[model samples]
Target: MKSGVTNLFVTVIGLAAALVPVNSFAALGDLYEADFFSHTIFKFTPAGTKSTFASGQSLSEDLAFDRFGNLFEADGGSGTIFKFTPAGTKTTFASGLSGPFGLAFDAAGNLFVADASSGTIFKFTPAGSKSTFASGLSIPNGLAFDRSGNLFEADDQSGTIFKFTPTGSKSTFASGLSFPVGLAFDGAGNLFATDQSGTIFKFTPAGIKSTFASGLSSPDGLAFDSAGNLFEADFSSGTIFKFTPAGSKSTFASGVGNPVGLAFEPATGIVADISTRASVQTGNQVLIAGFILTGTDPKQVIVRALGPTLTSFGVANALQNPVLELHNSTSVIATNDDWQSAANANQIPTSPVDYRPPDSRESAILITLQPGAYTAIMSGKNSTTGNALVEVYDLATSTFSQLTNVSTRGFVGPG
Candidate 1:
């Protein structure tokens, strides 16, 4: 994040390289693709660097991630779902299923598994408690959830897509497809499904259908990056195709043998830190940072406004003093002109190691916010102006809830 002549960019820190602005890229974070025939899952970085995330599975069918950064895989041949930590340690999360094909996670951290052979949908709590969510389908191959919490299923055999409410109510979302094998939803409410007959279908929230793309080779799994680009795992072609929002396609990766499922690690998925640097000014030109917290639980974050301290790092024209304010939709929730004077001054220095503002005049705020939109503004006090930095750090990174969709806007004066 930065401010430079109306330029806008997003960066997800904490588990990747430092802040660098890029115009076009393959993915925001990491992308995981499962090869059904090889029984292996491979991970790729934004620059196309590849490595085996996990291997030696009994037919890896699908890949998904929980809010806590754990990766889940559906093992179709073994009838089990495996959970992998951030470091790739594997453990059997569930077992005794009749072919787990598609895996999805709801906002409440519940894992939904589509049993293709049994025609059943199973739900598992965060603690691994399982219950039957839905049943009597003709082979559900893919699963996804919309922002409204409605679960969508791709029934490959029946040629139908089904929508299920949070409480197990089911309805037909779309029908008459040519073996829909993969399902995904973009940031918008629109749904994308990959069909076995070399075509991708797009469905509106009202169930209206249209062909998003055609001439594929047995496309199986669908995933979308933060930039709204769709990645399709073309099963028979041994390749993955990336599609822009308008449906233009390009080869993202090749030589992938029988890729079945695709999932991006979600750069914006579980952000640990976000910061932006820009020239500060008054009124609308003040550095304003925006973020949205998803999931059910509240999140504790430390918001900071840096100015004088930046000069120690070779930043010139630093603001003499900075003031910071945190706001919800309607009103200001918290404000801090100086960190030492804040109500939680003692706790601010120790919230986390290596994150204390060196200058006492810098502004900081420690807030516990519920799931919603928020704004953090940084400006110089007394109508002063100079370069400054604004930052928000998530404190509870291991919790089920996370900070996401973070952005910033400000002015950029000449050096």
Candidate 2:
């Protein structure tokens, strides 16, 4: 029965070209922006409503959540960690450190701090005892833990990462990073870190490092969403990027004021810490430039239109039926089609009934039309049982085209 349903769905999609005109309208929705310098965090819901969670912290660079639902903020300016309870009571959990930038908690509830000033890592037990876990580092800024309780630190000054055993012994896990800062771990024990130069690195537990993603402007803090997508906070551009383990990165949020930190709360989606600039609505369109998928698997991709005027667009897949849906500010507004299949060479769209694929070397989907503010959302999966690469472009001048060549696993959407 399931197979029959699937086949019917495929057949409907295969006949989509004849139904093209039925899929091109949209509705507008709410939008929100964050001011990093203002120390404010704004939330935008599906209904277009906006809310403020917190504000007024001095140069907050990283954030972590405790078991009690409290938000711990690393105030790099004050060299302290500020704890904000669920009730909004703020207090300094630890202070008097040299540029405390990143914080992490182990399974035993011990808090680890990356001190950039002293080039060391400090461990604070739940009872508040401060002890040096490792010292003589080179500007350690981000910290994470593996399944074996091993600690990983990203040294920004040396562009190296160190792994500390449970016995306080440290070894070089990876080196030659471009000012690596933020660190996170996938369930498989692989370490992911971001550099201040707008790149992401993946390292094996034994110390081999590889470039995971690039083309960012000062990618700082890193987080992972529920779907295993990595999120990055771009300090220079005031934006957030959502990347896949395969190496594809896309803008998750924009117009943020120098976003320096990122955290994912299952209950709140993604939280970012803006360290510089003021929050303002710049009226700039959140454009999806392109994407890359570099892993060993083939991936799938789906594209959607978003925003108040999203209903004005529809997706016509070469092998599927045209799907028309209303655009929600928070909802993905595109059809679920095999983007990899649509990317074949010399492919073209013949009304709502015919379509053609471009060459394999072509990295982007070219759409020539009038200019206006728009957002393009894409999801990718492996074509050969692994992952996919789908890149979208915001074209202007009718001849200006967007391009993406990254071959990593992940989705790209408007932030």
Candidate 3:
């Protein structure tokens, strides 16, 4: 029970990739939105700043990002597609389109556009050569390409989704959709769609369809983030909604007029790492782990320390009592002796904060922090020693919905 010998380990459960709400203080991602009525495209940063990404267009209906970081927008009114570089440089990539609505890129760099006015699907080469990939559709509006190079078009007028092979042969994929207008695919090869009826639908690789979510205000576009969070643009409400892989929904951004396109930057911001040990005591010294949070806003995080409960996991000699402290450099910001202490009880309630250690002797704290490096320390109370757990969870993204436990599993010992 001396003050310097120990071991530790932890497991974290938390939020996935999606557009985070601005107030949560975490940058969801770099997002580009198209205003169909204004004929403008706007860029939103994770820091909650909105600015013009590109403008001077005619009815920018949909957006897509290629592997090289170029942004593409389909101009329905001008019957053209415009491409933009990261520095906001714009150029016409394709023309002679007939009210292009949805835009997508295949793995080989070919572009596919859904022509609403002509009821045809057009394919564009990297060099701008255009050809009719599929014709005779009843208003193909939203387009998506699966991993296998299968092209999908949402025929809004016929309420049928059509799937096409890379060779251009087409077949009906699903029916009964209400004016389906946008389509996206997740990493697992599943398809998601939104429609004028304010519903979002999910489809399995085998063509099984199910309602992923309902009751939106005319959702028009669908896109997913690295962690499987689905984002949808609502044309009527001028808002964007985020849905978890499990179908939980939350408002991501709001107050834009006639939003038609929503695309996440093909990049990630918050990468988390956790360190663990089997046991820690005062003799083992305080277990300290550090992390850096980028951006200007304060990041809301939950920090916790666990003991006693490890016995359930077959951990022998679980720390009888573990204490936790959060620090900026060497300055202590918060500390906890027990998780349910009145000081932090108000902040640690509800589902996103679920999976609290069952042992009353555990410790936890919730903090909103500015951009910088910080450290979390876990130690046994009164120099008592045993197995324990320490974890830091980012709360900015999970503030609205089902944010599970933030834990990490690892083993640690001094050299």
Candidate 4:
């Protein structure tokens, strides 16, 4: 018999409350700028609303965000690196550097700084232990990391962009530039550099270089948002320009005082869960929810289907027994019929948050997934039809990965 479901609603809950500070107010996808002349860090929303994120730096040169959303600033004028909580409390992360110019964070939570005056790159452990990572360059101005953990640096005086292996083996990635000051990498592995000569350049993973944009006013720092849009700090013109993936340009913000560093807060907040409440049925009428895991690290998540528990939440026609199936690109990866009987039932309760199903007949699957797309489908056992709630919960939020682009599909109208 053909059946349908109506009012199928889906909600993606981001665990931002745990990562964002009480006083800090920047949403994900917002752009942050280090205003050098203003001695302030400015926050610009995606719609161009401006606010002061942090203030009182001697000379804010570059900005980077740790996994926890804390902002790190390079103050070249004071030769110090300042760390600011999301709420704006500031502390010195490192000091005594010779003209700190750039900041970046690797997957391991280590911080890298470019010391322009000393022509060196320094690495700092999470515990504040410092060590020389690379040296003897000609004015290292900007630092960035590729997915493979290789470090890229722009040498302002040498007109070259150098790539360094994890062990500091250096090789020139591109050359013949005019004062390249800022470096960034897009999701597709392409490198972008801002040349103070009023131009921006793009380099493929194989080192093929081409001009991305030209006729800028001393473009200094560049960064990419999750959507692959490039934001450039036009140092001399006091404007921020955004370029789309296809090279279309537009103004993102203006009237900033010598913006030097630009960074976009991660678009996907730590995902708490994505829940879909729909009428569960059999065959092609079942509820299916899809999501993508992005970034370079693996993420642990719990998928569950709640049927009887929905009765307590005003769902009267709840399915007594629900079934859940997880898929990776059309192949069934896992399935569960009862939450308590799953092989990893013991580990389900230990998730970062308590996410145990209330009824023994409910279904749950706890698994760790690599960066990819996945789907979870929920249905009623024995071809029965009723209301059911399917959910996916992220358990490992500290990793450099996130769950995003959640969607759902099901038949329309009640089954």
Winner of 2 and 4 under TM-score? 4
Better of 1 and 3 by TM-score: 1
Candidate number of the best lDDT? 4
Cα lDDT, all candidates: 0.82, 0.53, 0.73, 0.82
Candidate 4 or 2, higher lDDT: 4
Writing each residue's lDDT as its tens digit, candidate 4 over 72-121 gives 99999999999887778899999999999989887656789999999999
Which residues of candidate 3, in runs, are more than 4 Å off? Answer: 1-29, 268-415
TM-score for each predicted model, relative to the true structure: 0.65, 0.54, 0.58, 0.66
Which ten-residue region of model 1 has the weakest summed lDDT?
14-23
Per-model RMSD to reference: 9.9, 20.1, 16.4, 8.9
Of the candidates shown, which would achieve the greatest TM-score relative to the real structure?
4
- TM-score for model 2? 0.54
The ten-residue window of minimal lDDT in model 3 covers 11-20
For model 1, residues 305-331, the per-residue Cα lDDT tens digits are 999999999999999899998988789
Question: In candidate 2, what are the lDDT values of residues 95-164, reduced to their tens digit?
Answer: 9988888788764456788888998788886556799988898888889877567788888888888888
Q: In model 1, which runs have C-alpha deviations exceeding 4 angstroms?
A: 1-27, 268-270, 273-415
